[model samples]
Target: MADISFAGQVAIVTGAGNGLGRDYALELARRGAKVVVNDLGGSGSGVGASATAAAAVVDEIRAAGGEAVANTSSVASREGGASVVNSALEAWGRVDILISNAGFLRNGRFEDLTDEQIDPILDVHLKAAFYVGQPAYRAMRANGYGRMLFTGSASAMFGHAWQTNYAAGKGAMLGLSNVIALEGSAYGIQSNVLLPTANSRLAAEMDQGFMEIPAFAQALQNADFSTSDGRVVPEFNTPLALYLVSKDCTATHGVYSSNSGRYARVRICAAEGWVAPRGATPPSIEDIASHFDQISELGDFSEPMTVYDEFTAVAKAARKQGVYP
Candidate 1:
């Protein structure tokens, strides 16, 4: 296959100072994108901000002969979101891709999760995607081309012990991206979600001791974990992210999990189960108890393409059972 290049495209990567975001920004720039490297430079818990983190990434991009500009704006507020996009417009004239990868986590069990922990996590991971995408979306609509990617998480899909706030925030991103994909299709804009697992500061914060885990250590011992034998360190989970935001990627409203150089698509589907008989007045407790297994079965399931699909299924079932004339 031919090489995929961004060429004249402009990309905005949030939290681009380091880790996965930095990897994404550099890769996009190397592939010919003029990038906006946005980083609030705050601690992992989302307190305070600095310009150094963003500036350093931008400096590195330029030194490597790639174009980049720094923006130190929080993704948790409307003003901050607008300011980041404004920096992109001022520096590059237009935004063709938005990689909403900015996020922070405060881990706690469900019972211990506070409003303080819940609010910022949602503000940054979910709401900020909306704030930044809105303006960039408008620009894309006018130009008739755009690609958007939201950073989702495996914790949201598979559950995590001490990550109620984090999981809730990431789960909301799936809904956000799905809606954008549906709405943006007419305007030539596409949106998708990515669940990435990588060794970043956030991962380090999750458990510093995870680095020394036996499984990871074993892989390192075999040299299987090395992407570049001691010199050019590889951030393996980034390719899926870059592909999702590339112009050639026509896929929309999809979810994917990526890690350790492997990628897989994730999907949400409903189970097909029991259908009530004609004139059934909300099956009794005894009746439901008897059919519970059948009611929960997944065999012969139907995928609902829209909200109306559920209504249509109900209507059809009613007619089939002679419940409706």
Candidate 2:
């Protein structure tokens, strides 16, 4: 196989001061990408900021004979998000790759969570994608090439206590990436989501008891989320993330997971649910209860790419029962 390269490509990695984002920036720079390492230099809880973290990473890249610049811009705000992209543009003239990896954890019981915990999570994880992504998308559309990767989490798919705010933000990345894939198809742009589980300060701070429930516990046991020393380090996830945002990759509208050493595609499939009768009167509660098994069954399923595709699947199922022409 030919080696992958990002020569002449300009990349932006948010939260590159530490953890997974740091790994991403370093690797992209090694592969010949001119990277803008954007990090707010705040704590894991999104408290304060500094330019030191980003600057240090930039220095590392330059020391290694790679090109990179530091941009300490908060992605949680509209202006800050645009500034992130602008840094890449001003330095290298265009954005060919974007890794939306900036975020922090604010955990609490759903009912006990306050606006402080919830609002910032939304701003950084969900709204930041829109703010930073819009400008990057425009640049990619104009240049006729781009690769976008949205950082997501397994907590969003599987339940995690005290992470309602975090999960809510991570889960929305799938929808955002999917739409971008569809819209950017004609322009040679690919967008994808990465659900990564790695050991970092954020991981260390998580309450181990949060996964005490049988279901969550079982998920942890089933996945070998550890390295030789029993630590799932960030390097385990960097390879997959790098590929997804590389010019060689052709995947789009895809959600993939990198947990421990495991890599897999995370799909959202619609079941061939039971269709009620097409008569004048609608089905009653008793009718629904009777067909509950079939409705919940996953023996047959389809992965719909868009709303129209999902509706078409339902229409097909209805037609099979002679409920539609």
Candidate topping lDDT: 2
Candidate 1 residue-wise lDDT, 1-325, digit = tens? 8889999999999999988899999999999999999999988888879999999989988999999999898888888889888987898788899999999978765676799988999999988998888888887887889999999898898765577788988999888888888889998999999988775677544733334447644644675545533322237767888989987788999999886656899878665555666575777788888879977877655566567787777676566547675
Candidate 1: give its CA RMSD in angstroms: 4.8
Stretches > 4 Å off in candidate 1: 207-234, 312-325
In candidate 2, stretches whose alpha carbon ends up further than 4 angstroms from where it belongs are: 208-231, 279-281, 322-325
Name every residue pair that clashes in candidate 1: none
lDDT over C-alpha atoms for residue 86 of model 1: 91
lDDT for model 1, on a 0 to 1 scale? 0.83
User: Residue 207 lDDT in model 1?
Assistant: 39
Q: Which 10 residues in a row give candidate 2 its minimum summed lDDT? A: 223-232
TM-score of each: 0.87, 0.94
